[model samples]
Target: MPEKVKTDLGFADLQCRKSDVGRISRIAKAAYSFNRRFFGKEIKKPFHIIICYSRKEFDDIWGAETDAWLTGFATKTGTIVSFRDDLIRKYNPRKEATLAGTLRHEINHIFYFQIYGSYEPAWLLEGLTLQPPFEPFTLMENDKKRLKGPLPHLIYSTNGKTFFKQAPFLYSMAFLATRH
Candidate 1:
């Protein structure tokens, strides 16, 4: 059970430590703005943002084993939970991961869910989540022979247990597929 924290923002209800509340609120606000700009529309729904400070906290909230590579998640349009970037950086030391990007990616999920009611073809969902400054596109990264191999089917079709087997390639390929 997590304690709820009050936030004076209209876009989201934030729950985190006193030290992180402001930063998370700011990032969330900025991410929502980016989403609004990307979608070229305005959304007024209030969402929840939970900042988890440890792997145990995140796993407890998730009620299962989450991928070690992921830093955050948008459980649905109404809520998102993220691990502290600094605490999780060890998992993505070379991946250029950041707290801002995680929030942006997760919030995009909420924005799209509001629009399409449900985002399908996990590739599109995953792809759309990787907007500029959030998860930049790269042709390929080193040690990614999985990309050279036959690309996995759409991201959703792949079982969640193995969804991140080749995440780097999946994200890159998804970005390419969704890029206009």
Candidate 2:
């Protein structure tokens, strides 16, 4: 249903249904703008997106490779898969918001690599990056939705050991720590 667009870059490619172009473009632009605002300048990077009709289609697109190597990767070395998408027909009608979150999250990884030479600790990267005060989510309808909350069980460390055990809870706690 969607047409394929190949850029001169030869690396990035996208396929989308005829109706989704405007929506997808707007999502990408907003993500780009958000990144530009917090980080001092805009970055022009090659991003390839496939508009999937279903979650199966998304999975297929995700598994496709550049040559033979997998085109995807997880943010963590031990975590084999980098990104995952769930197509919620009803709950996920907000594609633009979804796209915005995905782009911002992944792009933050690249930004950190540029600065620190590699992804820092999960707590540091995810902790600070999750800072909504820095770049808030696009789904907010009012001040309440835009509101920031506390992270409940966060534990910080100069060394990585303590933080990785209960990363999720720790990150949540860390986020709360920043608020208070």
Give model 2's TM-score versus the native structure.
0.51
lDDT of 1 by residue, 23-129 (tens): 87888789889888888887667888888877888889878877787678776547888877786576654467777888888888888888887756667888887
RMSD of each: 2.8, 8.7
Candidate whose TM-score is highest: 1
Model 1 weakest 10-residue run by lDDT: 137-146
Q: For residues 68-147, what per-residue lDDT tens digits would candidate 2 score against the true structure?
A: 21222223221112222334222333333344566555555555555465555555665555578544533223322323
Runs with alpha carbons beyond 4 Å of true place in candidate 2: 1-15, 60-97, 134-174, 177-180
* Colliding residue pairs in candidate 1: none
Task: Name the 10 consecutive residues with the lowest summed lDDT in model 2.
Answer: 76-85
Top model number, lDDT: 1
Q: What is the C-alpha lDDT of each candidate?
A: 0.74, 0.45
After superposing candidate 1 on the true structure, give the runs of residues whose Cα lies further than 4 Å from its correct spot. Answer: 1-4, 139-143, 158-169
Whole-structure CA lDDT of model 1: 0.74
